[model samples]
Target: MYVTEYPKGDVDKEIDKLNKKLSRSFSKDATQVIRKLQKANCDALGIGRHLIAFYPNTWKEKDKNEYLRNVKFKTNVDVEIVQVGIAE
Candidate 1:
């Protein structure tokens, strides 16, 4: 997922817009996927891991979840469909 934003906008509003966009894009199976990931205690987004990689010292001093809670994420996904079969 990738996000491009206007240089000057309300940060929280921009984040909300991005979240809504992502939710719409992944609406079909998003709930189920979220439930499964939460149940498994998995961070499929790699957010924690990425933070650790980029800010090892800071990560080592703080809880990953706490850090995650303070960070904002924006994502974009592209979907392509190909080869629809004839109905029986």
Candidate 2:
């Protein structure tokens, strides 16, 4: 349910906006999980993969950091509260 924009503006600004959007969309627990996931440098959202897949020739020749530094991300989360169980 996430939507990302490649705005015609500064990359850092875009990333900052994206971070704020994602943080607001997720719960505190979910935010912590995302931070942990990011700690491993895992682009679970497939952004890096998409770039590599669509731009293979260019990707092969370019520095990954250069590409990643300019990349922006936005994430949305839907959490369903499945059960409110009795305390055991």
Candidate 3:
């Protein structure tokens, strides 16, 4: 996933738009994949071993934090901030 904003229009608006997209892209289908695997697991589901690589955009510090927080707090997955911005 990539979060980015060019130097045009309103940055906040762009960030908000990106946030909305981010929230929707990684959906319940992802969870389902894990669930199916767990159904066959002999022991622990061990979803915590999986990494949900999250790379949300830059500040709107509050919004960015909230987005990442929701992903981390709401899910059993461990998310890693792999990168910020599209490039550089």
**RMSD values, in order shown:** 13.1, 14.5, 16.1
Model 3, range 1-88, lDDT digits (tens) per residue?
4435456555445665655555555555556654555455421433232322232223323342233223322333323333346465
Better of 1 and 3 by lDDT: 1
Candidate number with the higher TM-score (1 or 3)? 1
Lowest lDDT 10-mer window, candidate 3?
47-56
Q: What is the lDDT of residue 14 in candidate 2?
A: 57
> Which candidate wins on lDDT?
1
- Which of 1 and 2 is ahead in lDDT? 1
Off by over 4 Å in 3: 1-12, 42-84
Instruction: Please count the clashing residue pairs in each candidate, in the order shown.
Output: 0, 0, 0
The digit string of per-residue lDDT tens for model 2 on 1-88 reads 3333344654344555555665566856665665665666566767668868897887787666544544444445644332332345
| Model 3 residue pairs with clashes | none
lDDT of 1 by residue, 57-87 (tens): 8779876555544554443343333222233
- Global lDDT of each candidate: 0.58, 0.56, 0.42
Distance from true location, Cα of 12 in model 1, Å = 39
State residue 40's C-alpha deviation in candidate 3, in Å.
2.9
